[model samples]
Target: MHPPTWLTAFLDLPADEFDAAVAFWQAVTGYSLSAYRGEREEFATLLPAAGDAFLRVQSVESGPAGVHLDLHAPDQVFEVRRSPGGLAYCLVSGTESERPAPTTWEDGNRSQVDQVCIDIPPALWDDECAFWASATGWELVQGGRPEFRRLRRPARQPLNILLQRLDEPDGPVRAHLDLSADDRAAEVRRHERLGAQVDRVHEGWTVMRPPAGPVYCVTGRVPSADPT
Candidate 1:
């Protein structure tokens, strides 16, 4: 199959915590929750007020809470597969074209869940990066930092793709959401007020554990900046 033209990020939550996770995500992103779908109502999309949806949530029957991606390629029937680095992803079809705007919080600071970061073991980094670049047909931009690489996404697409080489030698690849914030500290405080906790602080980003979902990061990147 040809490379995917569009993609949607899925926040896979444990079955018991699904409702709470959805609520937390909605408050953080300012997105409306779509009606739940799938047998047993296991799926839902987070609807942006101004753009086509690009983020979804799944109430998984099994497996720990984590994130995944659905690559939207033409003519592809739904299928699940693992990348070279073992990150789980789906192949599906979609026509999402309008990118959503960054959410402005009550304090005037802005943030957007603009990227999905794939954490890859050091040994598999090269192969994993190549797999994603070929799979998505996006330009792979090498990062200045040795540990990171980026896939340049189309402006109309809602999320950018980033591959991070982990210090570990080998392990399953994992994915997480990344929010670009206009004021990093302010955004962190806002999320904290919503029940999230700071996991760790880095030089340009802070890791956080939302009250109900997988851990993610709040980065110092400007919400309006091009996500290269």
Candidate 2:
């Protein structure tokens, strides 16, 4: 497969929680909702003020509600498939070039929803990481910790791929969004004000559960760094 020209993270919400999920995400990301599309009006793009949007929300009729990534490349028919570790991803033809700026909070802290962390069972870790690095044609940067591996994203690409080695012996692969913030605590507090709750606070990142979707993390990384 050709290297993706762009990457977009999609929050797939169930029908019953669609509106609430859209509202919560829009509030946290400071993005304006675009007109709903799709046959059932179940898809909407989150438009950024200064750059091309790299995020969207969709109402799903079946299957689990969670996040998925869209790999955008030029001149291709849309296709969806499961990764070696079983995470679902889409290949779309639409092209995107601009990357959105991080949102600056009232407290002078900045944050961006920049990375998608794939949680893979220990046995699947090696193959999963190899598949992603080859599939995306991005530089694979070995993580400092043994449990993590990151893709060194291209300059214009909006999202980073993080492969997390789970401790479990075997299980279905899953993914979660992660926000890098200048001040992790402040960002967590802001999200809490928007109806999110702290799930756990680790030394390097804070786990958070939004009012209406799967859990994510607020990490202590710089908002502006592409983690290149």
lDDT (Cα, 0-100) at 204 in candidate 2: 89
Global CA lDDT of candidate 1, please? 0.88
- lDDT score for residue 52 of model 2: 80
How many clashes would you count in candidate 1?
Answer: 0
List, in order, the clash count of every candidate structure: 0, 0
Q: For model 1, what is the error of residue 142's alpha carbon versus the real structure, in angstroms, after optimal superposition?
A: 1.6
Candidate 2 on 31-74: residue-level lDDT in tens?
Answer: 89999999999999999887788898999998767899898888
Error of 2 at 53 (Å): 1.0
For each candidate, the alpha-carbon lDDT, in order, equals 0.88, 0.88
Q: RMSD for each model, in Å, please? A: 1.8, 1.6
TM-scores of all predicted structures: 0.95, 0.96
- Judged by lDDT against the true structure, how good is candidate 2? 0.88
Per-residue lDDT over 115-198 for candidate 1, one digit per residue giving the tens place of the 0 to 100 score: 999999988888999999988889999875888899987867778899999998887899999999889999999889899999
Clashing pairs in 1: none
**Clashing residue pairs found in predicted model 2:** none
